[model samples]
Target: MKIIVVNDSVYPLTMGGSHRCVFEQCRELSALGHDVVCVTANEAAVARVQEPGGFYLSTYRRSENSLAKALGFITEPARIIGAILREKGGEPVACLSVQMFPSLLGLIWNVPKLPPFYYVYHGSYAREMWTQLWPRFKRSLKVSDLLGALYGAMMIPVERWVLGHGRFPVVVLSNYTRRQLIDDLGVKDDRIVVVPGGCDTQHFSHSAEGRARIRARFGVDDDTSMIISVRRLEERMGLDCLIEAYADLRQRSEKKVKLVIVGKGSQRDYLERFAYERGLSSNELAFAGFVPDAELPDFYSAADLFVMPSLAVEGFGLPVIEAMSCGVPVLATSGGGHSDLVAAIAPQCVVPQATARALADALVDIFSGRTKLPDRSACESYARQFSWGRYCSGNLAVIDRVLAQKSPPAQTRA
Candidate 1:
């Protein structure tokens, strides 16, 4: 099978569950004897010379803001158009596209050849912007968040069209996203396939020496409790809520705990200020910025618990699975993809309400010994099922099915 995926970026080159998920799918497809070509706009990949397995052809320079992103989208079609022209066709290539820039543009650009394009739908960014930004806009009256929500509101129709068009098969990363397509946009149920995203279970598996080293690097001692989160420091991530929860947890408990927040974003200065306002001491909280890909495992190994306090619906929490794979218990907000990861292992820890009081109570239960965490071995076993190998295999199976339906078996001579 020849697979061509068009998306904004890939992992290491970029961060985010969607970016990493698509890259893993492409990487796995290439390893499974398919010629995979990833056409992206990630600045890091654009600067690089080459990659292993298949290859990368960039469409735009790296983007940091919405305005730059819109301009980049305007230029994206050119590279993809050239790539399509270069392909020597035999069997129809499966062109996989996820929701970032409008899928309409990709389909419109490829209309001449009209390749067998498949839409691998992640969560709707428009829905994300509206859900996560509107409240902030309402309260702060910030023009920036209003503009973000307005952009999302404007794109809702595009997203709706992408999901509902009968011609394309929508591959969603989680059942939550599948529901969004159906319940929110009226997409037919059969058109959507729920293929859960995966984690590097083996890489994040427990390591004692790694844990000790990571603790030393962070200046956290063995006796101190460590809570770690690797989520992007964005508004929807609920980092502010986590800070409030952490402060409440600190005041209630006699034991001192260390909170290490990793990953970088515009929210850093705001989050730091908020933390201090919430009475979090510098020693109690540390922002490690972005940990490199090579050292992420050690950070997970160092965690006593992993927490995902997302205020909005996550497509799938890859870090939740990664931390669980490392034998660390996870506490996440209920009512989103976070439940998909926690249900089998730490179902009880899903905070019913995503708020400081609720989160603090859950933390108190675990850290204060009121609620015992599930066995580390059980957490490891549950996480093992969500490996990248399994995810890739699932992706291939669906694409193979799609191709088979397109080209039926020829009749034999009587």
Candidate 2:
């Protein structure tokens, strides 16, 4: 099959779970002998390039200006559609995998002649924005927060229009997002399918040598427990809660422990300042910003546990699966996909709430041996169920089903 995967950015170039999902699926599709072309809006990309993963990449130039960047969400896809039309000559490909920003495509090109496509809905943009900015608006009542809230408020309708525009099948990473679509956007239940995110079990497997090397590099001895979190430093990501929890754990636990946070984001400076203010010293906490993709498995191997403290709009927690694939147990807050994964692996690994106190208590229980976690072998065994092959199988099934359907009436709304 010939597939055109449309997304905002490709993985490795733009690091995120959604990008990784799209990239991995493309790789799998190519491996399955399909001709795959990834269309992205990465400014660094050339006109057309082929990835080592055996798929072609067609990138549209994106502007670097602040205003252009903000409006690029809508404008960029228009350029993408133009590129697709110019390249394909208004002809339909075998399949279209719309990963992000489905608005312009649905609005501008909903002709019956277009090929069947399915939108991979990561999560509701309105819910994600409101989750991050609503707290700030409530606390400060700032104009920026007000504007952000309004923007988020407006996305509810935007999301609705995009999902309903073509009545296309929507594939989500979790049932949480499926529920959100049904309740929030009025998307029909039958149109949504839940396919969990995946981990590369082979690449992300445990290595005793890697564990030793990474721990030594981080200055954490085997006797000293190390809690690892690989998350972007954003408000909804709940890294602030993790830092506070780590601080609390230090005060009460007699065992030596350290926290190593990997990844970079806008909240890095604030998180560093917040850590210090919470009385965490350099010895107790380390920020390893922007580690390369290949080195992530080593970091996971070095950790005794992985924690995800997402406060809201966490469609699927990919890091938890990655860590588990590396034979590490996970502790995640109860809500969204991380908790779902942890609960399925072992119910004891999930924290009761997304609060600092709850995280601290969970840490205490695990360290004190009051809560028994899944063994390394078990963690690895369970992680195999979430491989990219498995994810792609479910996704491909949806694609096949969409392709078999008759073209629905063209619908549009603003």
Candidate 3:
């Protein structure tokens, strides 16, 4: 089957959870002998498209001018419509992978020619924005905060309308996201398909030699305990909470432990300051700062445990699975999508969010050998179930079902 995957960004260009997930899906689909063309933004287009892959890639550059940026806010749907028409030529395309802004664009522009598009609702942006905004308002009252809240409120109605009216088959990355779409956005239960995001299990799995090499390279002593947090340094990630938790753990534990923070973001300075304020030395907390993909496995294997303290804004915590694949025990917050993934593998380690004491306690338990770590064999076994190959196959099955139904497009009364 011929498929066109449409999104604002793709892998190599955007190295985040969503970008990686979409790229994996495309790769898997291509492996299954499907002709896949991925359409992404042109900023990182050349780099991403040049990679050796089975799927074809095409990109459109959005203008960077101030006027264009302002216009894009209103014309995003029209732009996607235009791109689709140009890409389709005169032949009918079978399906389009539309999400977020592009999903709404597909609804508005494709109208009569709309294919059986699959909407991957990674998560609700408005909800995330609101989550951030509420905390700001509580901390300090500001005109900017009020304006941001107003903007979020304005987008909520439009987002809900697009989800409700599109009526396309929806593929969600987590059960949490699926529930939000059905309960908050009023999307039909039948239309929603829960295809949890996956990791490259075989690629990420641990080897004894690889683990030893990684530890040696880091100058880590055999007895040293390593705690790794692989995530963007963003407020929603709750890195501050992790640092506080680690500080609390250090106060209680006599063992030698180090925190390795991977990935970089806007909150680096703030997180650094927070660490210093907690009296943590540079050796105790190392901000590795954006390790490349090829070196990711080394870091994962180098760690004794992985912790994701993200309180919210997480549709699916991919690192937890990656760590588990590396035979590393994972302790993640019982909030958002992490709850679902961690519960499925290591329910005992799922702790309450923002509870630094609980996080510290969990870490101490692992370090002290009080709580049994997740069975390495079981971790490997559970990780195998969420391979990219399985993820794409499930998605293709949904697309085929959506296309075969042949339901007439629901009319919109504007």
Candidate 4:
């Protein structure tokens, strides 16, 4: 099969769960004997490069001007994909659009010749923006966040039309996202396929040396329990709640515990200030900023426990799976996709709510031996099931089914 993947960004060049998903899917499709062409806006060393996984990567530079940005997003990707289609010259193909904007614009730009599109829906962008920014806008009364919320609010209708039109196939990362589409956007159940995002189980496995190195680097001793969280330092991530919860936990628990927050974002300064305000000492809370891709597994392995304190839009916490894959127990808020994975592995590990009280109580329970967390082997076993290979295979199966349904007539028309 010949597949053209259209998305705004690519992984490693630009990091995120969605970008990683796009890169992995394209790589997997190519690996499975399909000729794959990925057109994205991620600037690499070259405009067009062939990846080791047997896929072609075409990239475009991002513009500094606002109007240019919008125009480029619509035109640049379409132009690249148009060139690829012309080169193929009537080959049977399908489009795997990773984002709505690119898909919508690309379809408009090349309506006559564009192939059947399979939308890789990663959750509603408008809803995510509203969920993440509205609360901040209310609290801070910041003009930027207010405008952001409005923009996101406006996207709701646009998403509804694009997702539901023609009843196109929409691939979601979790059942949580699938429910959102049905309830919020009124997308039919059959059109949505729940393919839970995966982790690199092998790359993220337990490493004693790595564990010791990371722990020692952070000045965490063997006697002290290290609670780790790997996420973008943002308000929506609930890091503030985590800090408050850690303070509460520190007050009650007799054990020596430390919290290590990983990843960097605009919230770093705010989080640092909040940590101090919570009366947490430097020894008790350490911020490790911007961990590289190669070293992420080590950070996961260093944790005795992993926590996901997402306040909202907690769409499939990839860190939860990565931590579990490294033979570490995970506890998360009882909502979103990560909760599903955590609940399936150990029901007791899911925090009852996203509040500080709830999170703190759960931490206390685990430390005090009141709640039994899963063992290293158990976590490893459960995480192994959601490997990237399985995710890719599931995607390919969906593609096959969609293509079969769109049979000879559709192929001839294209």
Candidate 5:
């Protein structure tokens, strides 16, 4: 079936997990003999166009200037409608997969076309904004916290309107998000589908040779234990807590453990400052900011342990599964979807949220060889469960189901 997937971002842009997930799913879908056309904003369009694959691509200027950025917030639906009309040429558009911003546009435009649109709710915008705002303000703009909170408050209505009025089957990345849609948004159980983010098993597979090369490239000695965290340097990521915990672990551990932080964001400077304040140097913490996707597996395999100390609003921790695929044990916070995934794979490793002491203790346990690493075979097994092929198939099935059901409500000429 011909499918049009709508998201604000896609691959090569390297913005977030959702962007990469959508791009990978689309690539896999194209490989599975489906004609898939991806529509993204200007910022991500160039990347998708450059992707060496056979998928139809359309890019649009979603916004013009800074002023347009704020105003284009309301124009997203019209832009999507324009793109659909131009591309589909009146062919019965099968399914519309709506991400966060474009879901509203899909909801508004689908009213006339009545296509089976699936709302892929990654996480609640309100929760994400709340998690990001306070820490960012405290670290960067202390006075801006109130303004950030107000902005979040203003976004509530828009978020509520989209979730409430979309009236389409919801595709959530985790069971945790599925429950949130049901309990928080009052979405019915039958209307929700859980298809978590997937990994390219081959790309992230366990490789001893690759690990050795990556270690040598990073200047990490073979005898030294490596702890890697592949996440944005942001407040919600709990990097501050991770750094504090690592400092504590350093004081006690006999073996040398180096923390490798991958990815870059606004909070990098604050984290660097925090590390300095703790009397740690660049040697103890390596900031290999924003490693390319191709090189991610090396980083994963080079590490002895993968750490994710996210506090909350983590819809699904993609890196955790990637690390698992690389046969690296993971330790994550018992918050949001990370708790669910970690529980499923290795429950003993999930520690309390924001508890640096608990995180430090867990790290020390792994460092001291007191806690055994997860079974390599089991790790590989879990990784198989989240393969990109399975993810694409599941999503395609949902799209087919949605398309077969109904079109958008017909529009009455005014």
Candidate 6:
């Protein structure tokens, strides 16, 4: 099969989980004897023009931040169109779009020879701004709150229109997201399917030597109980709540503990300030911003506990799964799709939403022997269920079905 995968934020350009999924799925599909082409809005994708392993590449100038990228994709749709046109001389192929912005590739140009397009909805950004930002921002009135509100207002209509306009099936990460698209966004019930995000189990597997080395490099001793939360520095990530819980944990636990926060984003300074205000210091709390994807398994292997404290807008908690794959136990809030995954793997670890107190108690129980985690082997076994190979195969099956039934929809964007 010949295929084209569309996503502005793909691997090597952005470390976002959805993009990582795009990278792995495309790579695996290419390995399966399919002629795959990745059309991206990522400026850095120029480096991959010749050949990125088995798949081909195309690039465009997609700038920084959500707002700018949103505008760039709409204003400059030529790169995506040209890539599709170049492939038009061959056998008819299907394009798998990873999100809303990239799904507009054909619609923006009104391409005449477009093939079947399959849409993948990671989550609703509009819902994040509308539901998550308003309550938090109205109190402080940060510029981000206002910007998010505006972005949400613009995205909700475009999101719905695009979902309705296209004659393609919507691929979602979980049952939770499928329910959200159908119930909240008015997408047809049969239009979406749940194909969960997958991890590279081999890369994320346990390593005792790696754990020792990573901990030593990070200035953590073997005796120190290291708790790590690898999340994008954003408002909806619930880092503030996690920090508060860490403070609370310090007061409750008798053991020596340290907290490590990873990733980079707009809320870094604000989140750091919140950490300082909570009485945490450079000694107990460390912010390791933007660790390389190759080094993540080491961090997870070194951690005593891996946490996902997302307040909202988490279509799937990929980090939690990664950490689990490394044989580290996970503690996550019962919000979004984290709960469903956690419940499937380990239900005892899910905490109630928006409460540091509950999380603090859970932390104490885990470290204090009040709550014992399953053995590392058991944990790794559960994590292996969601592998990248399985993820690609599921998406490929869907693409095949669509390719057989429907002709590509004509451009309907206004």
Candidate 3 error regions (>4 Å): 42-51, 62-81, 86-91, 102-112, 130-150, 217-219, 407-414
TM-score for candidate 3: 0.86
Looking at model 6, report the run of 10 residues with the lowest lDDT sum: 98-107
lDDT of 5: 0.76
lDDT of 2 by residue, 1-414 (tens): 778888878797788899899899999999998888888777665666889988988776766542244356555555655556557443347878887653334424443345667888887766676666667677667766766666777776777876765478889998778887888778888888899989888899898899999899889986899999999887888999999999999999898999999999878898999999999988899999998989899999999989899888778889989999999999999878778888987998888889999999999999999999899999999889987998989989988888778546678996
* Candidate 1 to native Cα RMSD, angstroms: 2.9
lDDT of each: 0.76, 0.82, 0.76, 0.80, 0.76, 0.78
What would the per-residue lDDT of candidate 6 be over residues 1-414, giving only the tens digit for each residue? Answer: 777777766786778777888888878988899888777776554634635757877777766454565556554454465556665477655554546543464444556666666778778756765665565567667766656567767778877777766667889888878887887778887788788889989999988988999788778897898999998887788888899999998988789999999999878898899989989998899999999978889889999889888887778888878988999888888867776788787788888655888888888889898877866887799889998888888898788778777756677988
Q: Model 2: which residue pairs collide? A: none
Clashing pairs in 1: none
lDDT of 4 by residue, 382-406 (tens): 8888878888887887778777776
Report the CA-based lDDT of candidate 3 relative to the real structure.
Answer: 0.76
User: Which whole-number lDDT from 0 to 100 does residue 225 have in model 6?
Assistant: 87
The candidate, 4 or 5, that scores higher on TM-score is 4
Question: Candidate 5 residues 1-414, lDDT tens each?
Answer: 667777666776545878877887778877887777777666433423535666767666655332244334446544654556556454556667777653455447544654556877888765666667765666556555646555666676667776766567888889988887877777788888888889888889888888899788767897888899999887788898999999999999889888999999988888999999998998888889998878888888889889989887777888889999988889988867767888887887888656889999988887888877787788878888887777787788788778667646778999
> How does each model score on TM-score?
0.90, 0.89, 0.86, 0.90, 0.88, 0.87
C-alpha RMSD of candidate 3: 4.9
Of 2 and 4, the candidate ranking higher by lDDT: 2
Which TM-score value belongs to model 5? 0.88
Tell me, what's the RMSD of every candidate? Answer: 2.9, 4.9, 4.9, 3.4, 4.4, 5.0
